[model samples]
Target chain A: MFNRAILIGLAVLLACVVAPAQFRRGGGNAPKEGADAPDFNLKVLKTKKKKIKLSSYEGKKPVALIFGSYT
Target chain B: MQFLLVYIREAHPSDERRGRGRGRGRGPEVKQPKTFEERTEVASECVENLKLSMPAVIDNMKNTAGTAYAGFPDRLFLVDKKGKIAYAGARGPRGFSPEKLEDSIKAVLKNKGVAPRKSTKNKKSQGRGN
Candidate 1:
């Protein structure tokens, strides 16, 4: 009875508390802080076609990569 | 600090349109770009509409950059000089936080280890000058 209550309380605490923090710290299916950014040589949108390499910015300026769409 | 808008495949693609006009309607009736040129057109519209001054880039047909960064709908990330992701914002349209990202940007700038650039051109980006 009391043991079951304690078990239920612990389960609720884990779900309500610990899980979110874990999810935040742990990277899932994506890159997170401190991870090596995957290198890419994408096409720059311009009048003349050009390439934008992610690794090219290495050891230089901190690149702010904004990824999205026009939808 | 440098900025690049990596335009990925459409999220709510115009084909998936619902509703009526601009306010009443969902959005423009633009189809998923079939070619790099088509994608560039849409991306240009986005940049112009937002009045974004930053340079923009387009993801490949296979969305290599998007998939690698888990950037689909939209997201912001700051990579340090070492090419390590310093700040990886959560999935966007929800995790998008100009405030949080700003703080991270300031933090990166404050760290003197990553020095700023001069009037130098990116060696590898010859034809890709911005």
Candidate 2:
């Protein structure tokens, strides 16, 4: 009986964690096609440059955003 | 004219500390950075090593750009002149296709009445160009 309860508990935990990811496949929560991309300000490493915000680039040119890490 | 690379959480966070390969294939071994500075160090190393030509934005909180963009591994987005989302490419590895991004950029530029200019940098090169 204890094993059965533990198994059910683990199953519930897995579902809670993975369900959100599965539901949010590619394009999840991201701006819709044609919607304005949300603007953000992020710090640039190793420079005196000020924070960079998406709105700052408006009307100047198109912006390509690449999100990743070095691994 | 603008490209933003948001460095988020490490993809192979587990393998970051030490070089994992063998023989001539050996590489530098550094642990997964637990803080923003550590992550930035690793990121800077990668940029220098790859000679990438695009600028990068570091997501320190690991929330804003990282989680918001679903940027665990990697993703690409093209915001057009009007600031609208022109194209959204699939995620990395199997979904990672540089051609798709290049094609999308070209298409948007053409639509915006701009000329097509081939990238001088190698396709695989990854770095944050100043």
Predicted chain A of candidate 2: TM-score: 0.60
iRMSD, model 2, in Å: 5.0
Which lDDT tens digits does candidate 1 get at residues B22-91? 4233555567788978888999898888798888888988989888877866788888888887777777
Best by lDDT: 1
In candidate 2, the residue pairs with backbone N, CA or C atoms under 3 Å apart (3 or more residues apart, or in different chains) clash, namely B16-B30, B17-B29, B17-B30, B17-B31, B18-B29, B19-B29, B52-B127
TM-score of each prediction: 0.72, 0.71
Least lDDT summed over 10 consecutive residues: which range in candidate 1 chain A?
A: A21-30
lDDT of each: 0.74, 0.68
Query: What local lDDT score does residue B73 receive in model 2, on the 0 to 100 scale?
Result: 68
> Candidate 2 - CAPRI tier?
acceptable
lDDT score for candidate 2 against the true structure: 0.68
